[model samples]
Target: MDLRLAVYHAAREGKLRLLQKLLGGRSAAERGEATSGAGAGVGPPLLIAARHGHRAVVDYLLEQCGARVGEGGPVSFDGETIEGAPPLWAASAAGHLPVVRTLLEHGACVNQTTRTNSTPLRAACFDGHLDVVRYLVGECGADLEVANRHGHTCLMIACYKGHADIARYLLARGADVGRRSLKGNTALHDCAESGSLEILKLLLDAQARMEKDGYGMTPLLAASVTGHTNIVEYLVEGALQQEEDEEEDEPAAEGKKDPSTAGLSSSSSSGQPQVYCTREAAVEALELLGATFVDKKRDLLGALKHWRRAMALRHQGGHDLAKPEPQQLVLAYDYSREVSSMEELDSLVTDPDEMRMQALLIRERILGPSHPDTSYYIRYRGAVYADSGNFERCINLWKYALEMQQGNLEPLSPMTASSFLSFAELFSYVLQDRSKGTLATQLGFSDLMGVLGKGVREVERALLHRKDPIADSVQFTKALAIILHLVFLLEKVECSPEQEHLKRQTIYRLLKCNPRGKNGFTPLHMAVDKETTTVGRYPVGKFPSLHVVNLLLECGADPDSRDYDNNTPLHVAARNNCPLVMSALMEAGAHMDATNAFKQTAYELLDEKFLPKAMMQPFNYVTLQCLAARALDRHKIPYKGFIPEELEAFIELH
Candidate 1:
């Protein structure tokens, strides 16, 4: 390693003696010259030492070498890199109190923030470092109201993290309680959603109003959505008590309250219904809480309990809260209906299967299919079914989720790519399972073909707007490899004449899209390369696969198509030592004498160990025309104007 990087590493590891040994009493200018230029990769020496809580090393660098205290450099937290984080911000975020104190004592800016505008105090509050928070705020003059780019404040993070003492300190310091984030969520809403009942109480006592967020959710509903039963009950009970106190204090000049409005109050002054107020909010909270119990907790009995309470509340007044109805019955949900009456809801407990179906329906209805949790729970349920040996149900539910993601997410979205990759892994695992005749069902052609068609559609969508770059190459390549794996798996299925035609039509559509992966590899290059297996968590599919290669050629993949390296698929086949694939490509009219950029023909590129196998081919597939093209190119004969444009281009391939 470079001496500069070596010194930087020693400083980061907190070895003060080693750092001193390396510097050897050099002058400040010499030391600075030794550890210059952002420490190469690990930020400056002082930044890394402070980030890792190396107070001794930090002092040595600051007092001895005069390392800049306020200098900003790259720092990473929780696998995500936060660029340009100062020493104080790194020390504070890492919860190193002494290191933070040392940096602060050395004249570090207290209000210094990261590239994201997250402050030292905010970072300290995030991890519940009360001492660092106190030092920064009470002594160093750290600004409490300095929010990050997303407008999230220190009080909001403190409350959400359930740090009661820190939250109290911030409140005592007059951190604004009603401050809303970019998403319109206040500290009380965050506290409720994170299940911090104590913080919720603190915010409520601070007069935090019941307000709607960007999602139109109040604190009570936020509690319900996150399955915090204690917070829900508290918010509901408080709202009810406040409503009674208001009724007692109101003037009689307003006239007697209508007898019909029992559980709910009249509309507010804005003419908008005050549904977020009084019992109306409580009713909605219970309904959403029931859905949370069903999907998130997977507790059917608990869901039933919440639903019963909501139904009881609904029936207490002349006006019943309307439950939103699905416009059309979904076959995926087994056409389950939302139970409006208590009798219908009560009957669900007798049949567990029906109860589970009701849970899926209720969650989808309440949260909508667009929410990530809705689809995540769906996939989770399918995986549970797969573990219990119910493979058919698992496949059906996964198919539904893939369809939903395609409809909702952007084309070439990572979520959709993940779904496609999951299908590839599942199909590969099932096919390789020896007990398929007894333990698992037979693989079907449509099952693999359907996902391939969707994968092709994603590619086509990305291609439709040519002005925009294709989805980043990683996503594009993974999708391409998965589609090839699906094609490989389809051959394992016994298809009828009609099924075969449908399969070919899908393959044709994919070929016409002409999508390219990394290295500008066409489908043919990917089919012959061995790296295709590492696309997923599992070893998804084998490559240098003759079956997939044949399928590509049969579907009109060009045999002589050149990649970015100008190596045809036959060259890739040769590098993999795949004689059978090379023979097949040669049979499909691939030129054997076509030299790549390295000027090596496929036959010359063959591995020495594979020579015994290469000798078994019927004959060398190189032709007189190919040799003549190669000779003209090698000798630099000027044949461009004399030959046809197509033939002239062909000669350049050598």
Candidate 2:
């Protein structure tokens, strides 16, 4: 009854004969008319036929039924207009050779460009359909040289993707051997990039020019860099033959530069004699492909040290800045292999703690005491100790590592300072200002606050001496943590009137130096939120206490500064279900309508889950003010919008 459903079923069922009979009887002019879907009449029928690979039905519809193809059309199912693709493209992509042939035979443009500017041939090539490629190229005479929207020719794509059969077919059909893309990439460049020897040989036999790409890299040179030996060898042999042939042609031109040889040599920017311009001449590529070499231990170690130095210099600039010479890559490869053997030792020890200890022993044996490597193992051992909950031993081992790191100039670099910050923070928070009998404590690391304070002073002095910004940040953060811990310790020391006064002084000093400090919490933020932090050994006393909040605000701390989520310090106080702290904030002019990142205002966020109904009495004044402001500011729909429904009750309360 519905022509759209009948057409849809006929296309999907591949009822070609039925489709031809029903649609063919109509006049060509009327048959071309698109039948809209019965429901919303949004999409047409031909797109559904094409998209589902009902090519026989597609051919009948387009050639006989006269269905519209490409650009602006529709699907009956979802009303999605077909975007720039013809039925032949669908046929070619689905590898329906018979349907493709039929459609092409009926003046369906074979080289038709779709929305993406992809031709039928490009679609067939991308799908790796050999029969379809042959049909599009041989039968339909589709242009193989036509570039896609990306300017990639069919042959270049096939070659680059390692579709050897398609590549050979394009080559045999006289595809442009020397054709270059918009980025100056030849067909051979694609083969080199893919590292496919079969595709490389096919292009080479087609006499693809041996030329440099956009990066001044010849196809063979690029292949070599990626370590493709077979491609390298074949090109090398071809190049040698070409060289001999050229020399024979120019026997009498004494001292006259041969054009081919001159072009090859002058192609590179470095001006190195490009003798090994052939694919086979990539010795580094060949060696990387599978070459092995023996090295004397002395030479190996020396090379390792030298390459490491060069690698460090490269780090300071970039990998390209300190471009390793050919010898350097070769030597570094071997030296890197020696270093890799150390990783094997890592696998032999199953337990990480034991392995870390063994790694330390290896570092001590190989690098000697007082070396950077030795100090690294000592710090690693400290980490293992810390992770195992031996906080005392962690403190001991880290102190030893710090002492050794300080003694060695290389060990005491900014890198070491960065590493110590993590250990320092863990010690302050976890170890509870407890002095472990270590070299650091023996050298008067009696008070953690004193040692941390000295670290701050040293970092400041060192900052002046070296102008190291990275070192300054790391050291300053570590020092600020110590002061926070100092404030924390004062809060814990038996709460008295004197202790309260002392706590105020300590927090104010922290706020002065590190205003918007570590962990996104100022000392004031920490003081207010200390109830949430679960570090047991050292806490800023039992939290949610009114005095801690009162003293903090009294010491000139801003109660309005928000956390990352835009929750003001008062919002944190409320969400913690602390009515006393809430009362203090409300008394101190804390805004109640302040919304967090979630768009939930402090009044809206108050829940029975966290805050009971009894908690509402304390929050009544601030909530009422917020509601009254919203009610007073309400306007018409065109002007603004109606007030949020949740605010109505609070507005009534106000």
| Top of the candidates by lDDT | 1
TM-score for each prediction?
Answer: 0.86, 0.44
Q: Write the per-residue lDDT of candidate 1 for residues 1-654, one digit (tens) a residue.
A: 776787888977788888888897788897876555463766888888888999998888888887888888888889988888999999999899999989988999898888889999999999889999999999888999999999999999998888999999999999999999998999988898789888877786787888888756678877887899998887666445544444576644546454223335322446332322466667667877887887688888898898898777666434456677779876666667778899998998888767776767766665567766667777877777778867677788888888888787777777778778878888877877836464445567778888888888888987775453333666678888999889887877788999898888888888888788887788889999988767778876788889888888999999999987899999888888888888889999888878888888887777787566446353467677778887897788889789899998788876
**Least accurate stretch of 10 residues (summed lDDT) in model 2?**
289-298
Question: Model 2: residues >4 Å from true position, as ranges?
Answer: 1-10, 13-48, 51-53, 63-66, 71-85, 105-107, 138-141, 172-174, 182-184, 194-198, 225-227, 238-281, 287-629, 635-654
RMSD of 1: 4.5
Local accuracy by lDDT, each model: 0.80, 0.55
Residue 283 of model 1, lDDT score: 66
Q: Point out where model 1 deviates above 4 Å.
A: 27-29, 37-41, 70-84, 105-117, 141-151, 171-189, 204-219, 238-280, 432-436, 465-471, 595-604, 610-619, 637-643
lDDT of 1 at 557: 94
Candidate 2 differs from the real structure by a C-alpha RMSD in angstroms, to one decimal, of 15.1
